[model samples]
Target: MSLFYLLAVILIASAIFTITQKSPVYSVVGLLVNFLALAALYFTLNAEFLGVIQIVIYSGAILMLFVFVIALLSSGVGPFRAGPNRLPRIAAPALLTTLVAFGFLIFGIAQRPFGPLPPHRPTSFLGNVGDPNVFGSVGDFGVALFTVQLLPFEVTAFILMVAVIGVVLIAGDAVPQPTLGRHRPQKRAAEREPILKAPAP
Candidate 1:
């Protein structure tokens, strides 16, 4: 077997293990390993820029979010149970979606045309030597964001900001007030005696 195929097999196994793991923390670790393997695969494909993005976005940002969510929602033993029918309800839709996606993928792959790709002059050298904005450079990205796709870029940023704010608001503690200890008995207002009473006629 080729080295790439072997790596691909390991990657698929790791991904499946990550999904099926009972422990959220362990799943996150497995996902991290999967991301690293995917980055290695991207490198093998000679897509250095995409590999860096996989590390930065998937391995760094998304994994951190997952870890934070797991920590917030669970206490290591396990998370709280949902309604009895939740699994079946969720599972049906998920299975349908998966089948649909697989069908589309098979159809597309079968219909894809195979031909020699057109050759192009390398842009990397000119970008490195002539242009100040090189390929995959921050400056080039910024220019593209503001010049070509300014509105969409701003909209995406706004959506992300809203998402962050919503998460913070949902996770924020309610206004804390003084509280008696958990075991302490609560005093009833009626328990206190009236200060004054009318005299008997």
Candidate 2:
């Protein structure tokens, strides 16, 4: 239980850090931490295949792609706005709605009557007749992914492909200098004019 809590905390913190981080590289690192945490959680849950997939696909491949795209597109750290904005106001209602929805979901789940939980071993279907305890096994994972979650799996793969294509398209061209937002950004070190020192009398 403590391990579960620890993993959950790390995952949430890393996810928040990913979004809140200033440097894109640092953000990517934070996301990597999130991916690692998720993989660990899967391992704890005895989902070895999912843990491997999480580490290989998300942490190794996708994040490397993100880093490559960022490096290819941007020359250096660019100017960023520094001030309060309407973004929080826009997100607040959606966040509140989601929280309320989750509250209802939890309440509903808690209301269900409890039964004697199955044994600690994994469960398997008759199709793989030889292996009785094959839950989270490769065969079970493959069956579920192809049969039950086929559409979602395909959609996710398509989305990833589109993201890669989009990144390549954007990075292939010379990116334009971004215009400052409502707030004036601080001048870069090279951009600031040095003050002339007065000669000693």
Q: After superposition, how far is residue 162 of candidate 1 from its true place, in Å?
A: 2.8
lDDT of each candidate versus the true structure: 0.74, 0.81
> Which 10 residues in a row give candidate 1 its minimum summed lDDT?
121-130
lDDT of 2 by residue, 1-201 (tens): 699999999999998999888699899999999999999988876778889999999999999999987876575454333468777787989789989999999999899877764677543332443344666767777877787778989999999999999998987675765667756779999999998999999
- Tens digit of lDDT per residue, candidate 1, span 109-201? 889976653343223322333234344444555565577668887999999999999988876655454667665676688996777978999
Candidate 2's clash total is 0
The residue pairs in collision within model 1 are none
Clash count per candidate: 0, 0
